[model samples]
Target: MGLSGESQAAYHYTTTRCEWEFYIIVTHTSGPTGRRVLSDKHKERRVGDSREMVELITSNPSALGSLVTCDESWIYCYDPETKRQSSQWKQFDFPQTQKGQAEPELFKSGRWHLHQDNAPVHSSILVTNYLTEMGVKAVPHPPYSPDLVPCNFWLFLKLKENLRGSRFEDIEEMKEAVTRVLDIFTLEDYEGACKKWLECYNKCTEVGGSYCKGN
Candidate 1:
């Protein structure tokens, strides 16, 4: 299976009645074909302003963890000192929801193969070394191929269908709504995605890795 992270920009009304930029990190988890949803993780925080995100990311994109959902009720808290790529991968070790808890962190062992996209952070020497240390194997991804990315073809579109034209009063409200969307996905839904992914993959391979013209 592949692990990928994408950023989404959303707007929310603030206490002062001004709109602010809410940046979220959407982690897509899917089967090997990049179809169907194994699970989805979201990390978000309100930036000082829309422009501030540019500066913040320029300085250190990893700092986005500091804004990650801190409430125990949420899956993962962005801990600057303790959190990093390792912790993100570790979340898969726990059951999605167990004993009425959401994303409870109980360490369990299992074999999970991961393919990460070529983001600067994902490809960095630090991240690669950490993944090697943690025994996670990296799947090679072709450069300049957005269509080959599963999230672009399926996951994000489905998410947009739910979130399009919706408005949130605050970041928390938006988080809750997104959480519901992620948790409500059914196994069959993911299975369908997996099937679609294979179909797309075969088409791409048939063309010798050139972009396919059809949906």
Candidate 2:
């Protein structure tokens, strides 16, 4: 809900490796803070795209667990969730994997989709071309659809809630606060996130993609 500062700008990129593995990338930027109002066109697209996601998840159930998604959020000096993030990592490790499954490398060339928001930083022609050249399948995220992303609907909110009201002396202090919150997350936390992710998607489809709570 609320952040701790207004002097610094923080952007977070969250990559969910599996049902229980994920990490965050933080970037600092200079900008304003506020909510984004989606146009009618964007709202329609959110409904259609989320419905497609619902179909994918319903048929496979473990579909998202198999795919790695990336999205950025704006962390104002006070709020650290919005649209300042990127997707350019080589590989990552997971805290845990599904039983009987080998650890997954999200970028095994065509094994995972690179889900990015339509932020200017993410949508640059260079970025698009790079993804195309690398044969990376891009997962489409409708604008103003954080309700469908786990980090937005769950992880970021958890961080804000835990880190709220604390005063960070510097960047290092803020980092420590964030890491503290992350380290305390357990298997149940991540599993719960996956459940919430799908439930939100279902609600999105039900509401015709307007706005759903608890997503």
Candidate 3:
């Protein structure tokens, strides 16, 4: 019922693949999720040249939609934009399609909320005020608590586990593997991740905002 984004490194060399940045929002099975990709620039050696590849990927509307879940909610990649434009897009254009869907409870725009970490880009005054004006609620995230975040606790861990020690001939091959993993992720998998997320949140709170030590 909420949206959030995170970055993961897709390695290029050494037979493994980790990219620079990937942003995702986790929600109920039938809701829209937003994803953003950022290029990884490294000083040592290049992982993969994503500039051209990204340009092509972003240009295709289908590419964006393909990132969605089984419910067919559209996921898009956005470029850097002015705060005003970003606000307008999020408030108006983003939720336009879901205006009348009634079959799935989660697809109802009224039930959707946004959850993201306290990064400056997400927590800026302009962004906060815009969300407030648009009536989008945000899920509170405690600082430095990755264990409580769905992507960190569930998505990324599972993703990396699947990618671990595997060799990819090229960036495209690596990407295909990543896509395969996502494509096969079942609704039950997403639900289980969210379930564990709630458990972790409760665990963190029970420890009085300190690290949750196992019982």
In lDDT terms, which candidate is top? 2
Candidate numbers, best TM-score first, in rank order = 2, 1, 3
- What residue pairs clash in candidate 2, if any at all? 3-78, 5-77, 5-78, 73-82, 74-81, 74-82, 74-83, 75-79, 75-80, 76-79
lDDT of 1 by residue, 1-215 (tens): 13233322222211111111122342222222322221211001111122333344346643322221100011112212223433443222222422233321211222333443455646788878998998763434544444544455665556555554445554455566565554555656655654564465556545544556654
Model 2 lDDT per residue over 172-191, tens place: 66665675566567767777
Model 1: per-residue Cα lDDT at residue 143 = 43
The window of 10 residues in a row where model 1 has the poorest summed lDDT is 13-22
Query: lDDT scores for all predictions?
Result: 0.39, 0.60, 0.41
Write down the TM-score for model 3.
0.47
In model 3, the worst 10-residue window by lDDT is 12-21
The model with the greatest TM-score is 2
Query: Tens digit of lDDT per residue, candidate 3, span 1-215?
Result: 23343322223111111111245332212232232232222211111222322333346643322221111112212213445544552321211112232343332334544556655656789989998998765544544444545556566656545444445554455555555555455567765764464465555444444445431
